[model samples]
Target: MEKNKEVSANNKVDVDSRRDFLTKTPIPELIIKLSIPTIISMLVTALYNMADTYFVGKISTQATASVGLVFSVMAIIQALGFFCGHGSGNFIARMLGAGKVKEANEMASTGFCMAMIFGIVIAVVGNIFINPLASAIGATKTSMADTKAYMSIILIGAPFMMCQFVINNQLRFQGRAVYAMVGLMCGAVFNVGLDPLLILVFDMGVRGAAIATITGQFMSFLVLLFISLRGQTIKVNIKNVRLNGFYLKEITNGGAPSLFRQGLAAAATLLLNKYAGKYGNDAAIAGMSITTRVMMMLGSAVIGFGQGYQPVCSYNYGAKLKDRVREGYFFCVKYGTIFLVFAGAICFIFAPDIIWAFRKDEEVVAVGKVALRFQACVLPCMATTVITNMMLQSMGKGIKASITSSARSGIFFIPLILILPRVFGIRGVEVTQTIADILAMGIAIPFAVSELRKMKKME
Candidate 1:
């Protein structure tokens, strides 16, 4: 009896030490420690994307616009990747929290397998219908060649991109975010270094950018695969990767919100490019591209922080610690809002300089400046909406999450994009996104409030 008591005391001490490590650490300090690495990873990614735009912009306005045209295709691929990654990561985190290590390992393997299969299918289909795909994404006669060249390489590299996402998300959920960051950072560096060499030295133009991006993705995949196999807490084994229909359903249901959100974003970009093409000049498309790249850079930082909060929220929720979930949510909103506000202000203040960094065309710069300012003004609202939606999704509130996800681009932005441009012309293009951001935030408020009240009740 005495020995049993002693063992119990020792276990208690160890558990208390762990709990102290998690809670006594300052919340903001922990968030920054987790998020800064993610931010660095995201910044590296954005830098390479910008490098692509910069190099491609130097080729011609048409070439520059072609990058925008292919963005929707990339978005679709990302939609799938995010769906698999986030869905599995959410489940894995919850499983770990519940002390179901085996289940988490199974989920990791299943998600990786699914991503690879889907990516390969997309690559085959996209390659076969390259022309149709390009046209559907708003490729103009002048932009078609560059679009095709860029997109073909991306399609072929789809499996690598998708697998990398699976590895990244799983690592993050395992509380190994630094490993995930390393993989992404390395890939971004590779892309950035290779862009100029391939595009300028090899005279490959837009295709060169695509090749560089694919190579980087492949390298990242290799690194992530190694980490997943040897270093991660979650073990992925092919033999254990069986199709449990119920688990599959759970993953898909949980992931559908991300799919809808990202898929609609891709569609919206396609429509924007198409509508801009109707203006009979590549300048409009190029301007939109520049504005989007800048906005995404800011958005990526916000998203990265939100992502940092996701695992914490999921783990606490699964553990039935409703208060911690609430705390994490509010913390995310506060940090995300402040960061976005400052970022928006900076973007607005340097709109012209930002646009001109990508291209020197007077027309592109003029159009991009207005768009950038409008987007900047809407950034804080967008950040709020993103955090709210992420909170709901990470908590496994699928239906509500899907509605929030669809609200911005699908329910509001799409119809507005189609209607406002008809009534207000090019100016409508700038205003539509700003209005959508505001409306999305407005919708998020009630949902967030209700969720908070529910958390309080649970407490």
Candidate 2:
């Protein structure tokens, strides 16, 4: 018992101190402090994904393509988890800022419960129609068997995966980004280790990879659940769960943007695979999937930076400190753009080498290199789009937030995916992301400017 007490003490963040730190610290210092952990968390999570791709690439081209197809399903599942988490988490930040601890507490538990139920539903429904689900995710004839093998087990672990995301986001919004990082990183580390062990040593093939992924997720879920109960963070308690209408609406307002963003990403992935398969076959799917995974790692830093800004944004906005909100926004945008530009330059220089590092097949490298270079050219544009969407969501501007969130993946990418490939062939898929990102940034700039102008007028 004494040992347990000592550990809790070490982990605890004083509730009052956290509130003060978020609201009163220097914007640059505060955001950097919070962002570092989140950035590491995001990158580590991306590494977890890459491990599966890297190891499974050793199995077969068909095996790699199967993982790609099932990734779309994973995206949809992630959308659900983020919806529950961000919805409740943003609300929790605002409520805490308003000094409504009770409301934050209730929301924490309620959001956790919603994700649990939604995940269970996905698992049961997904498995029952596993074949059709596989087909819809763009699994081709050769890849279907491997896809099902990986996906069936992945679906069973849905509850744990969803709940872990909820707790991670909730902790971040509570200004406990470190705790969130620890929980997530622990799982990623565990997953990375198991990827080699289960996939190779046991020679269980794709099925082993799936097993490793879920076991890692379940471990992260456990760690997060335990941490959620520690410190001054909002406790995810069963007794506090409320399914009331008011809370639901609040969740809709805050979380709808994330849902649209991730949901549309899944939609885009499905379309990308369809067209890629049509143009190039299983190799195209594997190629595009590898590039997409690499881009995800590149974007993770910006997303993490945006996440750090969110709690500060929501809290200060709630506390009516408009200046701090404005300050944090510009501060993040400046640094995020610089970081992406530097990173994008490196990616552009090493595009072929990077793609080859993932899968050495000549065709896979050919497809991935062009696509990666195009994406790298426009990577810096993502900073504004990501930051603005996060700012709007944190401030509860759902309609605008959803619009901005949808721009890159849904609003723009969908139509481009439909039209571009017809005119340009496989090259169209390679270039679609570049065009969408630039346009998304264009839309994001004006929205962010307008909001800042409004704050100025109010001041």
Candidate 3:
């Protein structure tokens, strides 16, 4: 009994210490501390994603296009994961900040449960219509077999993948990013190790790649589940599942931006594939696909860095420490833009070499080279665009956040892709995302400025 009491007291002290650390830490130090792990997590995740493209790139351009085509499905899975994770995680951070631990637990459990159910449903329904889905995602006859094989295996792991993402996000929002990073890194390391063995030695081809990816996801799910079950942060319990309108409403408000952003990413990818398929061929599709993945991999660091600001923003805003939120936002935008500018310059200078590193097809490299440089030119715009969207979402301004998030892929890209191809031919395909980035930045600027001004008033 005495030992248990001492343990309980120690836990209380730890919690108090964390609360003080989050509320009182200097802005630059706090953001950096939170960001490093999150950045590593993001980079590892991106690297594993690139691993599929890299290894598959060696098989054939057709096979690479098949991987690219199936990426739309992967994006949808990620969409749902981020929606549930960010929605609940944001609410949990605020609840914790306000000392509403019970509500935080309820949100965590409900969101996780919902993701699991939805993942299972998507997996079943997706596999049922696998052929049709493959065609819809722009799989040509040559790539059809590989696309279906890869996508089917990926769908089977949806529940694990989505749930793992939820747990990771919850940990990050709860100021446990290092734990989240470890879970993600372990899975990534496993995935990388399995990729070459499965694809080359075992000779499973794209199916091997799919199996490797899912295997890593399942491992991550187990790791994160163990962590959550230990009751270190908010424990995800079935008893706390509140699948009611109130929780759903909050989740929607907080997660809608992510849903819109990721869902539109899926849609935009499909459209881009279709347009590329129509204008050129499998090589065009392959080139654009490589461009998308590489750009996303490069952009991950900025997104991860922005995420570091999220818990700080939500926690302090909940605690009514508006000054910290404002300061963190300003600091992130300044540094994020600087970092992206340098990253973009490197990509722009080595566009051909980068594209060649993925797939050596002359046509693929030619198409991808121009696209990479064009997008990289405007890539710094994303620092502002993403930071603004994240800030709004973390602060519970869902409508504003959703609108800003939608602008990049939905409101902007869709129209540009449709019209530009008609006028400029294939060059339209290369530049669609660039125009979208500029427009997204234009939209985000006002929202970020407006919110920062409001935060200042509150301070």
Candidate 4:
């Protein structure tokens, strides 16, 4: 028993040593290994979203759409979460690259603390303004009750959601993507398991779905905290958690692009729901919700790849290996484009089936099918924006990254959603997102190409 225990301890030390070496490994290999876990983690995330739609859809179209209606609020919370997570993660990655372990630890601790505080604020504010907020996001009278119930639970759990993000991103920066994946996947699995039990068996409806989701998020948080304590090299010392103005500024600056992107996504969803509501009933809102969720799932793999590439780009840039950074960028774009093309093809081919997965209402299916097909057709191009913005942010080009991040949902899509729907009606609604995606890609090409050329010039 003593000898067996000795071997176990030694093996554990070896694994830790290997993980520690990962941060300093060859950038390409590190990214590939890191990204595979992230990809799986993201897929698990997508699965829960699908589960949400599926379970909610089983209740009623209104119930499913209510999930969609309140999606904007979720987006807002995610925006804040990403702002803190990405901001601190970027700083952590660079600091690790530069061997500033102490600084990295401080950023991690402070970022987690800040996210918790902000999440509490959002939870309070969200609950206080639940009715008005739901209305603002295009919840009709029919959908309003369901939306309120769902949003309330989500808001109540905002701190856990936000803190989970903080822990996940920080772990990734420490080159522990697998650990991060474990936490995410565990929560997702639990959520998926609970959805049916809560919604169907317990007959809890929309509130049940929300409860299940919150429970999953809390589990994820617990797992993430355990991983941080047990496996991570950097320790978050609460005593050392004083906010360094400069570090805070750096984190926020680095993470601002994510905030812009996610924040604008919330705005776009709200506007889309509102516009759709003006035309028809809750069905329209529901249809748009299902369509977007489908697109998001299909897009997850690409997003995962981009996320995988981010740490590589940041680490290489910090190490001043400009060539490696450029190489990783191009590799990610190529891989992302290919993956999106395949995903888009699948979405386009099965648009109806995909919509039906959420709800079987003929009208919702018809509307969602058209929207899904159109969005899928533009998927490849749309992926460019994700890669370009991620690369820019990873390299610490905050301004350019923010612009790229905002272009898709904020700069172009929001206005087009408003104008095109006015001119063309529901048809405009179907086409608006596609047009926005194409234009965003068009704009992204020049930026990505120009940036790459600049890297060559440096060479």
Best by lDDT: 3
Over 375-420, each residue of candidate 2 has an lDDT whose tens digit, in order, gives 9999999999999999999999999999999999999999999999
lDDT per prediction?
Answer: 0.83, 0.91, 0.92, 0.84
lDDT tens digits by residue: candidate 4, 1-459? 999888657645643454355445776677788789888877877776678888999999889889988778888887888898899999988887776666777888888888999999999998999888887877777888998999999999999988898888888766678888999998998899999999999999999899989898899999998887674356566765757788789878988999999999999988888887787567777888899888888777888888888877777778777787787777788878888899889989988898887788988988889999999889998668998999889888899899999988999998898899889888888888898888888778888888888888887
For candidate 4, give the lDDT of residue 384: 84
Tens digits of per-residue lDDT for model 1 on 1-459?
999888656645643443343344566666667677777766766776788898888888998999888878888888898888888888888877776666777899898888999999999999999999888888888888999999999999999888888888877765567888999888887898899999999999999999988888888889989888884246668976857896787678667888889899888888877777775368988998889888888888888888777777777777787887788778888878898889899999999999998999999998889989998988998777888888888899998888889888888889988988888777777677788888888888899999989999999
Q: TM-score per candidate, in order?
A: 0.94, 0.96, 0.98, 0.94
Model 2 residue 160 lDDT score: 92
Clash number for candidate 3: 0
Worst 10 residues of 4 by lDDT: 14-23
Off by over 4 Å in 3: 1-12
lDDT value, residue 225 of candidate 3: 88
* Shift of residue 437 alpha carbon in model 3, Å: 0.2
lDDT of 4: 0.84
Cand. 2 Cα-lDDT: 0.91
Lowest summed lDDT over 10 consecutive residues: which window, candidate 3? 7-16
lDDT score, candidate 1: 0.83
Clash pairs, candidate 2, are none
